[model samples]
Target: MRCSWLLLLPLLAACNSTPSAVNEGTVSRVADRQGRDTTTALPAPDTAATKAVSAVSDTLRVARERHNFSHAEGPSDLFRLVFRGPSILEGNAEFTITSPEGQVIFREMLTEPDLEAALVYEMKTPTATRAERETFVLRRIDRFFLPAQFHTPALDAKAGFPTDIANLERPTWDDLRKRPDAIGFEYLKGKEDRQRIAWSPLKKQVVRVQ
Candidate 1:
């Protein structure tokens, strides 16, 4: 009977020393058995919200694709570059003049309404550097623009250009001086805004408008 009691005592000791099924090891009750947060589960996707996001994304993508940033023309080096377009997309316009010898004469960003007034083709002094005054002929002139809508005439076979437009002749320097805008003390007063003549003395290019 004493040997059986000793065996039972050994069995009770073994049961007390064994690890428990409800382990208090490094884990929290707030987390599940898989270690995911019980309180912060991802909600089911809303179909309406997904459609709204998709629609906005498509709209922005199409707008980016449909944008036309380059639309302008220019003349040869002997003639001045004439750029005329609707004023709406004129903001943030860039004008680049490449030389015949594969050099960039000038690349300017102009926000003004008129390109002639915005840029000075010739240098004030003869001792200026190449960047200030390039002698190379204007090989190419490129104009770029930001995205904006412009109204223009629709192209059609029956739509012909109007022939009633009058021919314009270039005015002389003497004719420019006779104008009221170029009259007495206008240049000294810093009010050359209304000057009808824009001439490049070095390039021998002159443009006058009434």
Candidate 2:
């Protein structure tokens, strides 16, 4: 009887152990499957914002490149003046000359290659009666600078008069006297005589008496 009881106890214990083992196995398999599903179900990383920023940056770069290319291909005329000197005494100057008919004849700025520089400008005039009057106008335009001022007498003297006066047609001085707009000069000065020179609508060579 004792042996029979022992055998029954062993069978009962086995029955209980079998159910626990099955439950544990089922729970472990379910947990592993759930972990795999969780990993697989995650959405892929989104790169929309990064891609958008990169696109914008690329667009800006392309626009700048186009702008640089267009500027390089644009039409342009370059005029440059270089000055070498110590301290300039006179300031820079600029001037504009207008005809009696209010036409812009000449405009220029003058700067010293070195010391005190100035701009001298002469405009086409209608005609003048007395050359002195023309000289006065020129003087006024030059701001009455003794050095920069040039009168018809000075011009005549310089050209040796009657000899080099090519376009010597007597102008309608009366009209110029009434209008005084035949020829004119303008000088721009800063503090003294240093200034930059700018010329617009530059005419062909007038006198070549260098």
Candidate 3:
């Protein structure tokens, strides 16, 4: 009777283990299918946020390339020289002045590219005297001075003096109009020189010698 029970016990254990193994295999297959379906159902990624960030970056880049300068009220006799331009994304710049008497009065080198980049030089000479003849020179002190890269030329051809114009000849309105690069300079000739000179690119008008 004991031998017969031992053989029966082995068959009973086999029957119990086979059902659990089969159930476990079926559960694993169902879980794997559900996981795959969940992965497939996920929505596609949106690109709107990426595009917005790109557009903002382009606007900032364009703004950085633009530069301007102006002079307002100051000392009555002294003339104030104001220079403003885009800070180079890379590299440096130097500003210098050569007096009418062939003297180097002032010089400064700017290495801070993160700043707006401007220079102000005040001279003791009467505005009337210095107004007669003054030369301001801006030189690029960096190795890579590609005007096109910065999108702002080192010298604004329109606002800067022309190299071809002889010092003896006074630039006329017609002459300036012909050269788009010539910057209009207004000065008092006798009594009428107090009037301001204006140039509007948008309006396509040049009020010379105002």
Candidate 4:
């Protein structure tokens, strides 16, 4: 017999919140293992509840993804990342990562210009409407993070960089290679640029993996 499990985890927001931090992880859960398939998913949101929230609170209702990108050897060290914005048209977003303790570890903004740049990949209709452009940007944020975007062993098996670049890469490169099983998340810039990022316990911050 096959089994299906829906693991319900609490969201990173509380009843009331501040712009700087959240009290928990993002709201959403993936079907971790179901009949041999492990696909992350977003649960349907409550339509009425969504409408009731203030603009700042409304952002989390749009999209979220959760994963344990921890490189340490131990029990699963899960983390939550959630994106919020005023409206689909604004393209002004705040993506926050909540640590296990429900504290905001990192927060960054997705400016209007930053999101508009991706419109080159989205504009199928020439001379699109303002609403259309807004919708396109919102969809881009929704699909920003994905399961395939993370790596299991975060270091290149064998890759080279100039002396200066290598100097910057060596710390992360050496640390992850030793374990050969460290996991990290990849963030893309522009079309093909890739950056792998992971939590640095020693440094107590999120850092890039070269």
Candidate 5:
């Protein structure tokens, strides 16, 4: 029994001498002989991989916008779309629309060019500053879902469409014009190409209007 007690002392001394390890945040560390955490941190914390970026924040700039663009639905309808991105001048923006019941109705990823396209019309001179461009984008977003942006008479039944339009699309235009309550939002691509789009109840999807 005395010999067994003597052997346990060496094992206990060795155990006490060994350091203890710990992990905190992204850093790993050890305890010193005095039971203090080591000042030295293994590897390093990278500056790039910080917090997960938010919907409108890029860890630098921030932006967000939302609007109701309901046409077929009444005033009480909850149909709406949300825009999220870093800012008006940088990063791609995501536009997502959902139905009253929270089903995704439409979604599109818009580049910086798409949000800033209206700036071309305002940039009559090369002197346009960064502030001016940003303001234009803000105003564009405000009008994106406005009543004026939504055209009631999407198509003229008597008028002829461009020959370049696909033959299959002609029927869609014809069908839309017949519905008096149909509404579409007209938008400009780049500088001049104008197009109109609407959610078609008949097709249960988005449709283009002439």
Candidate 6:
């Protein structure tokens, strides 16, 4: 028994003295060999990686502010990144807003005027009084309706007026004619409505005039 006890003493001491190392994230630690653990942390990120991360964060912040959407409340699919010809921004691009399920909510030619109207329409809330309440549906029509395409200029000129636009309670066709570049149309659903008209010289699509 005494001899067996003597043999186990060295093994026990070896076990107690053995060195072990642990690494986690930026830290590396060595234990036991020197009777204490030593730790080292990884170096800071390089300038390029820091800049890349900051730029991406800034882009996301700008997009959310532009759409008036919040990362905490709204879905992540609010915006679609699209690349189009320069004309698209020169009041010549067409766009469609669809529901998450692919249901068409609105479609129209994006004109400079339409952008302003849409902004006003989105920013204001309807009031109880009819006199104070303004439905920018006519101003934001491009958000909802899609125009029909045509071949020749003559046919394009004669596509008439859209029934949806004609059905509006106010703002006659003559009022719309003043803004010749405005070509988007108004829409009315159960509890929602939108109206817009703009004429774009570059637009080949025609809206039937009633």
Could you list the CA RMSD of all candidates, in the order they appear?
19.5, 22.4, 17.7, 26.4, 10.2, 15.7
Q: Model 6 — TM-score against the truth?
A: 0.23
Q: How close is candidate 1 to the true structure, as a TM-score?
A: 0.17
Instruction: Report the number of the highest-lDDT candidate.
Output: 5
**Which regions in candidate 6 have their CA more than 4 angstroms from the true location?**
1-10, 16-144, 148-184, 189-196, 199-210
lDDT of 2 by residue, 1-210 (tens): 999998899789875773453454432222364465221233456887774333222110000001110012243222112222232222333333333334443345544321122222232455434453434333433333333332222122222323343433223222222321122222234335422211211222122111
Q: Counting only residues 3 or more apart in sequence or on different chains, how many pairs clash (N, Cα, C under 3 Å) in candidate 6?
A: 21
Clashing pairs in model 1, backbone N/Cα/C closer than 3 A? none
Q: Model 5 segments beyond 4 Å from truth?
A: 1-83, 162-168
Residue 183, model 3, lDDT: 33
What does candidate 1's lDDT look like per residue over 73-138, in tens digits?
Answer: 232211112332333223233433333333434343433234233234444654545442222111
What lDDT would candidate 1 get against the real structure? 0.30
Candidate 1 global Cα RMSD? 19.5
Q: Which stretches of candidate 2 lie over 4 Å from their true place?
A: 1-91, 112-150, 157-210
Candidate 2 all-Cα RMSD: 22.4
Provide the TM-score for each candidate, comma-separated. Answer: 0.17, 0.21, 0.19, 0.56, 0.57, 0.23
Tens-place lDDT digits, model 6, residues 59-120? 11011101211111243213222223332223323454333444434344444344333343
Worst 10 residues of 5 by lDDT: 59-68
TM-score of 4: 0.56
Residue 6 of model 6, lDDT score: 100
Model 4, 187-206: lDDT tens per residue? 55444455667666555676
User: Against the true structure, candidate 2 has what lDDT?
Assistant: 0.30
Candidate lDDT (C-alpha), each = 0.30, 0.30, 0.32, 0.57, 0.60, 0.36
Worst-scoring 10-residue span by lDDT in model 2:
61-70
